[model samples]
Target: MRWERGRRSRNLEDRRAQGAGRRTGRLRLPLPAGRGGKLSLTSLLIMVGLYFLIGPEALQGLGGLGGGGLPGGAQVGLPGGGSGDVASGPLRTTPAEDELVEFVSFVLDDAQQTWARLLPGYREAKLVLYRDTTRSACGVGQAQMGPFYCPGDEKVYVDLSFYGELRSRFGAPGDFAQAYVLAHELGHHVQHLTGTEARVRRAQRSSPGDANELSVAMELQADCLAGVWGHAAAQRGILERGDVEEGLRAAGAIGDDRIQGMAGRAVQPESFTHGSSAQRQQWLGRGLDSGDPAACDSL
Candidate 1:
């Protein structure tokens, strides 16, 4: 993505070291005593299903697995594990982590610069870089949840570990794919600033049955907004050949349908919180092609 050509963000805060507190303890889920006390797969699935009902944050913490990810934001506490209070310190980074830091800083700063001129009185949101798990105003922020923006704190949270999963599991390897994820979270910050997020929450309350559908629309709009940032980057020559393809690939790869299929589950449209793969790719292309924020009116 040629991120080195971009400016570094002054709003970047390192919380990686702070998030490295000791694990709370091992989870002891109840299992029916069997021959030799072996736990059955049915018992495992049942326990996991119980946690899932609690919330995404609780499910991930309880199972010690990270599967589903919302497009932009998260709410609720991390069910168990990790220290609640994270001590502040400078981030201790290795050579690879250092590269990631640089890339994130550049992408964030450039996105801020683009929004500033596009939206009058635009304020940059701080991007918090943490590891393992940490506290956020919205709820618990964990590496497994991927990148998310907390409107309550006006900050974007990310863990470097997510970049590995983006390449390995999502099959969207590239600096552009990583940037696309960050840009999408920042897009949520934009929605909050524009009062769109508040209005949507209110509407969701009034029409609870449409909650998932509204969420899908919100996520699709974020994807479009991310494409706007990509457009600006391209005009600045920061984007190289195939960068758009990488971003598009990421958009499709993380769609609700695709993620559900990846888990070997039924792709239920009514249960979709994020749009389908085609919808995501189409919206992203709309923003990139038009290079206008108005083109992202998914509502």
Candidate 2:
């Protein structure tokens, strides 16, 4: 949470002023047939989140919301230009939004630095700050999808407005909570670099019935990876009192069971793609307690 004195990342791509240049139609998610010949309520919401809340390529077995290859090391367009091109124009942003940008830049740099020390041959991933919608190698990224990391392009896309929703709607307000979001996405990038994501994708492909379970495991591991960064940050005196709690709250707030309950549906563990609130908190806490990436391998 002590980010004002931190170094800003050079890998940041700011395209807030460029605009999406196209209207995003209402997204309709297809509920594939599940157990018992019909998808459960939990399965339905998982499909909704798959198509709109996470990265477009988060689950490649599903239909293409956008075109891309495998989840790990997928060849795609480079940063700066493409469907999400940045046009030359004045950037309009309020003081609060500008501060948020600075904060994220600091987190991105700090987290990558930690990984560079912890993992061999670690590569830095770019973070794209956009408004409304932006083009990623996986697909068209909209604000509604929250924050996601596209392994195809090795870039993390974020819409700052989501922070407001994280606070007001999800009740997970704090700078560290925002940092956790970016850290988790970057964790996915780490998985991509290490071939963990590729292996998981292959497993999902081989076992179509267990795809959701595999997704839950992958997501929980990412949460733990985020906590690993949090542990490093704390040791460096970057975190203050209550920062860890903010992150845990954020993790719990977006848990599959909690989100299902919020939607007035019964909590179902079988359809969970991101684990339950307890599972998320437990994995994140494990990393925080151990400060070791190996501790996260239990997933």
Question: Quick one: best lDDT, which candidate?
Answer: 2
The residue ranges of model 2 lying beyond 4 angstroms of the native Cα positions read: 5-7, 20-89
lDDT of all predictions: 0.74, 0.75
Please give each candidate's TM-score.
0.79, 0.78
Whole-model alpha-carbon lDDT for candidate 2? 0.75
Candidate maximizing TM-score: 1
Task: Report the lDDT tens digits of candidate 2 across residue range 103-183.
Answer: 999999999999999999999999998865677877776665567888889999887766776786678999999999899
lDDT of 1 by residue, 188-254 (tens): 8888889888888889889989977887788888888989988988998989999999989988888
Displacement of the residue 292 alpha carbon in candidate 1, Å: 0.4
